[model samples]
Target chain A: MEPDVLLSVRDLRIAFDGVEAVRGVSFDVRPREVLAVVGESGAGKSLTARALLGMVPAGATTGGTIRPDLSDRRGRRIALVPQDALSALSPVHPVGDQLAAAVRSVARVSRKEARARAVAALERVGIPDAARKARAYPHEYSGGMRQRAVIAMATVNEPDIVVADEPTTALDEEHRDQVLRVLGERREAVGAALVLVTHDMDVVREHADRMLVMYAGRLTELGPADEVLARPRAPYTAGLLASLPEHAPRRRRLPALPGTPPAPGALPPGCAFAPRCSLAADACHATEPEPQQVAGRLVACHRWADTPDLLQEAYRASS
Target chain B: MPLLDVRDLVVRYGTVTAVDRVSFSLEAGETLALNGPSGCGKSSTALAVLQLRRPDGGEVHFEGQELTSLTDRELRPLRPRMQPVFQDPYGSLNPRHRIRDAVAEPLRVQGRRPTPGEVAELLDRVGLDPSYGDRRPHELSGGQCQRAGIARALASGPRLLVLDEPVSALDPSVRAGVLNLLADLQDDLGLGYLFICHDRAVVRHFADRVVEMREGRVISGWRRP
Candidate 1:
């Protein structure tokens, strides 16, 4: 692991009831970097994020090492901003108490000091009237306000790493942008790495510094976000980008990938995505291709060089 | 005349007005998308148009007929012409029933036993295999279940489909496919659609006209030029 890297995950695997939800995956989160893990619903993106915080489901066995830079503390050095903020927060208590609780767990601060810090944290996350609103219960806040409070709670102590799993999924377009902006600001303010797990390609393109694309519990592509969006090396990644209606002509048919992802424990032999890949060759069906370094990006495909042109042509045709 | 015309529609719950004087028209074979944030009254306006919930005030005209003034019995005959495709296909479908039975429901409701060919054809039209008719909703993926919902809506031979966030619940990989399928169906069947959505990108791409709602009112509407 690099000296500057805050979190290094190596050969991470998670399984439930002998079903491998996250097959051996390895990645790193550098200090002050936003690494987005992007994929569909069954792609194990959320599972990977959960594993980093050691919050995987009960009975789900995990393997491999997660080395988070904890030179400053002993316990968990990471915090999580869950998808549904309303449900994640305690409904019975005022929002201020939850924030103070998170702060107290991380530090040995006095109660009054913790409460003042809670209000400051809420203010940092762009919540207006922080002190007064902090006194309101979770139910009293709007969805966006609740999400902001959750973000405040997560970043109260300025952990070394933050894992936000679909944090803006439940919000509307306006709130989605607001939450994302607030997350970016808080990450920069705290100088902490952020692992954003979401299915929205547009969000990844806009906010992520680097992106890792997953399919069937395996990483298919990993690279800088802008480069990956402009020139995807994996067929799945290209198909996902092209499938967005915003990328295609107004009335043209979207380039949708044909089949759904394979279910866990029921994955087919060879590459799991071969059935849906339009460019799949005989070699692709023979065995799963290992991640190969190509063009400064890690891509697990037999024909990475050929994908950019194929997808570029499709995108151009749409325009 | 337009296939469906809604004028100054208002829907209220107690002191709170969910939809305030929303007016729009859906021509035959046109898709009119209503875009807004959560709690913005777009869904309420759609429900009011369908008469699923009675409007406090305003007019809804279907084929020159005033829907707001109709009684339940009076509206029964017109029900076949309008159908709704809800957000969660899994929640909308019957868990224990087979796919064929679910798709055949409208036909049965109309006093006709669906034939094997009819069920297979309906499934095929939605891009599902005929063999899938034997399976239950739980056996299918989110995308497949959504297709079944569309097929069920089509079973009624509706001229207009009020799609409430139809593809939002599905994964992005399958969302485009469903949207394309909806577009194709509109072209082939000359169906009008009142698409209720929170996604601005989808409204821009899929709808012929775009209407934006916020704070229980229609803010502005425009054609997709």
Candidate 2:
């Protein structure tokens, strides 16, 4: 393991009923870095994130290895900020009590000390009147406030890493930005790295230090956020970026990616994205591409060299 | 005259006013987006425009006919011309029903059996294969189910569509396909669209005009140059 890397995932594979959902995958989480895992709904990004915490669904089989075995020290060394804030919290208990309980569970602390830490965590996340709000149940808190509370809970233990799975997907634009800002601020305050799993490209562009683009449970691209956004080497990455409304010119029709992602266990031969790739060739159909160094990034596409040129041509033709 | 016009719409749930004197108009083959945050009355305005919920105070005119004053029976005929496609595709559709029967429901509600292949044609029109008609809503993916919902909406032969965050629940790739289908549908059928969406980028791309709302009121509005 690299000394700078906080954790390393090697050939991580997850299966359900003998059907592989996450194929061989590898990545490293550097200290205090934001690593975003992005893909479509059934892309197994969420499954991969959950597997880090040893929280895969029941009856599912997992393979490969995650270094340091952080699962044993869940709250103290690693924590999860789930998608739904309401589900993460107990409706019956006051939000503060939950946070305090979380603190007490991982550490041997007095009730008074734990309660104070809970209030402080709430304050850190910018919940107004933290002490008073602590006594209120989950329902009493508004949606945004509840989300902030969840962030607070995730960071209260001062974990080394936080895995947030589409934390702001349910929120509208204003609330979404606010929640991300709070999450970012809290993670910075705790000096914890974040593994953000989201499908929103804009969020990835704005918040991630590095991005892992997934396609049909396989890595298609992995690189620094700015470089990947600026010059994508993978055809799948190019297509996904081109289809975004914000990135495209305001037109009647967007240049959408041609087809839906194939379901797990029903993947196509060779590369999973070849069927939808405009630049796909016979070699792409015959053999799957392995991640190779290309322009400071790792791209799993045989036609990585020609992706940019083809992308420009496609854009010109569309415009 | 515009295809649809709403004037001084007001909806109150007990002490809370959801839609306060909100007004907008739409034209045939044009898209007017209602853009705002959640709880800002965007959906309430849509419900009022569709007459799905009778506004406490307002005048909704469709094809120059006032809809608020019409009884449920009186509005039945006009309802077919203006259809709603909700955000949740799976929830809007009956899980137990096949896609074919769901699409045929509008005609059946009017006491007319759909002509042979009409349901299949509707499904195909939305870019879904006609064979999808044999499957239920749960048997399809989110994007596929949403397409089925759109097919059902088209079965009524609507001149106006109230699309309330139709693509928000879908993935980006799937959303783009659905949005393109909507644009093509409008071009081919001259359908008027009252689009309600919170995504500004999508609203900018899809709508001809935009009505920005906040705190139950129309804060501002603009049109594409």
Candidate 3:
């Protein structure tokens, strides 16, 4: 493992009912960096993030290894901000009490001190009148305020890494940006790295320092966010980018990638994405391509060299 | 005449005013989008236009006839001309019923028994396989379920579709496919669409005219040249 790396994941595989959902995925989280995991539904991005905290659903089997074993140090060294703020919080208790309880669980502190820390955490996340708001239950707080309270709870223990899974999927654009900004600021203040799992490309472009694109439970591309967005090296990544209404030219129809992702149990013989890739060839269907160095990134495609030209041709043909 | 028109629409819940004097119009074969943040009364306006919720004050004119002045019995015949497609596909559909039955429901409500072949045709028209008609809503993917919803909406032979966040829940790739299907349907049927969406990029690409809303009022609007 590199000395600067905070966590190293190697050949991680998660399966259920004798079928693999995440097949041999590997990546690293560097210190204090934001790493965004981008993929569509059933692509196993959420399962991968849950595996980091040893929180995969029951009946699922996990393989391979995660260095440092941060699962045991969940609250103190690693924390999770789930999608539904209400579920993460208990409706019966006051918001401040829950956060204070979280602090007291990890550290030996008086109730007064824990309560004080909780209020400060809420204040740090831009919660107005933190002391007064602390007494309110989860249901009493508004949607945006509840999200901020969850962020405060996650950062109260000052974990080394925070894994947020689709934290703003239910929010509109205005509230989504506000939540992301608060999450970013809180993580930076606590000096913790963030592993954000989201399908929104705009969120990745704005918040991520690095990005990992997943397709059919496998790594398709991993590189610096800006570089990958500017010039994608994998066909799947390029297709996903082109499908965004904001990225494509002003037209009636977008260049959508045809076909849906193969189900986990019914995956194709070779590369899982071959059925949908416009750049697929005989070699692509014959064997799954391994990730290799290509243009300052690691791309898993048999025809990485031809991706740029082929993509341009495909766009022109469609238009 | 415009396909649909509203003047000074108003909706209230108890003492709170949700849609305060909002107005917009749509022509056949065109898309008019209602874009705004949450709690901006976009959904209220849609419900009012559909007459699912009677507006407290306004004139809703559809096909040169005023809808607000009509009674329940009078509106019954006109209801088939306008339909709604909601956000959550699974929630919008009856989980226990098969897709074929769901698609046939609109015709059944109008005192007609649709043939199975007609149901299959509706399924095929929305880009779904005819075999999908046999399966329940849960058996289909999110995008497929949404397509099934659209098929049901089309069964009514509606001239206008009130699409409330129709593709917001699907993946990006699947959303594009659904959007394209909607475009083709509009062109073929000459149907007007009242699209309600929050994503600015999608609204820009899909709507022929956009009415921006804030706090239940139209803040701005634009149309393609």
Candidate 4:
């Protein structure tokens, strides 16, 4: 791994009961880079984030190397802001105490010391009246404020890498914009690697520096955010971008991919996405394609392995 | 004439003006989305449409009939024409009841009970396995529970369904499936939907007509965007 690479995940395979939920997914999150992971529900996007945090729940198992160059088993160097604030924060405890707990966990400071640090973290995330709001419980705060508290916990220790999983899922437009801006600012201010996992295509378009498209349980494409989205190299990536409602003005119809994802336990032969990909040929069902660089983009499709212009043509036609 | 019509609607919750002078009309088979931030009174207006909470002023008409003039006993039988799909699936479904019984409640409540064959058909129609009727609400995921809720709401064969952030709790990827299902149901049944949500992206995709609200008032008149 390069010295600048803050977190390098190689061949991450998360499985449960002999079924692979995330199969050999590999990517590098560079310092000061906001890497957005965009995919559908069963795409194993959240599982990849959970692997990095070392919090894969029961009945789910994770293997392969998640290189943590930032810290050892010492625990305070990584933090996450999950999608649902109600589930992430403590219901009974004051929001200040929860933020302080994060500080204590990472810094091993006194309760008094952690409380002071918590207020600073709140202020950094643009929380108004940081001191007063710190004492409020999670339920007392609105959806936007609860998200801010989550960001504070992630920043209290001042970690080098922060993971946010669908951070704006349940928030209003104003709140969603606030949370996205906070992540963008926090990543620049602290020089931390921000990995945002969401299915919201707009978030990836507006906030990410790089985009990684996952279909089923594998990474199908990765490159510069706008380049990958504008001219997606993989059919699955193209399908997802086409389905998004933002580009509806340019297209007459929102092109929806037919059928659902196969059960994770027994995937289709060859490319996992072959069943749904329109460009899939006979070879896609017989051989698993490896990630290859095509026209300055990383893609995992056999048909486009030789020519990226074909992907561009197909993407435009579909939209 | 419109299938559902509301004019100069106002609702009060003890000095709090929940909905102020809101006006709209929903034609049969057209989807209307009422979108706004929290406490903007979208839900209040929806509940008032069903007469769940009596409005302070204005008129609500369905198929040339005024709903405000109906009494409790008179309204009970008319409820089958409009149904609500609430936010939380787990909370909406009765935890103690089986799936079959829960869905059948709406049918039974209206003095019409479906046979076991019909109940099995309803479950399968909503994409659930017919065998799933015996399972309890706790046995299903949030998405599955919501499908059961949709089945229950559809049991009475309502012409209009009011959804309050129906898929908020589901994963975004799963959310698309539900949205598609709703769209498909509208086509097959020729039903209208009052879809209330705050996601502009969703409104852009699913809504036939978009109405934006702010500060307990109709900020914009109903129109197809």
Q: Score residue A292 of candidate 4 by CA lDDT.
A: 88
Point out the higher-scoring one by TM-score: 2 or 4: 2
Clashing pairs in 2: none
> DockQ for each candidate?
0.84, 0.70, 0.69, 0.28
- Cα TM-score of candidate 2: 0.96
Superposed by TM-score, candidate 2 places the C-alpha of residue B1 at a distance from the truth, in angstroms, of 1.5
Encode model 3's per-residue lDDT on B65-102: one tens digit a residue: 99888999999999889999999999999999999999
> Model 4, range B178-217, lDDT digits (tens) per residue?
7767877888898989989887887877787878999789
Question: Residues A186-211, candidate 1, lDDT per residue (tens digit)?
Answer: 56776778899988877887899999
Off by over 4 Å in 2: A1-3, A309-319
Better of 2 and 3 by TM-score: 2
Off by over 4 Å in 1: A69-76, A308-311
Q: Which candidate would rank higher by DockQ, 3 or 4?
A: 3
Candidate 4: stretches off by over 4 Å: A69-75, A104-116, A249-253, A305-319, B8-21, B53-58, B86-109, B112-157, B167-190
Scored against the true structure, residue A163 in model 1 reaches a CA lDDT of 90
**Alpha-carbon lDDT of model 2:** 0.88
Cα lDDT tens digits, model 2, B1-225, are 999999999999999999999888999999999999878999999998988888999899999999999999999988899999999999999999999999899989989899758987898899999999999998898888999989889988899999999999998888888888898999999999999999888998888999999989999999988
Evaluated at residue B112, the lDDT of candidate 3 is 98
Identify the superior model by lDDT, candidate 1 or candidate 4: 1
User: Rank order by DockQ, top first?
Assistant: 1, 2, 3, 4
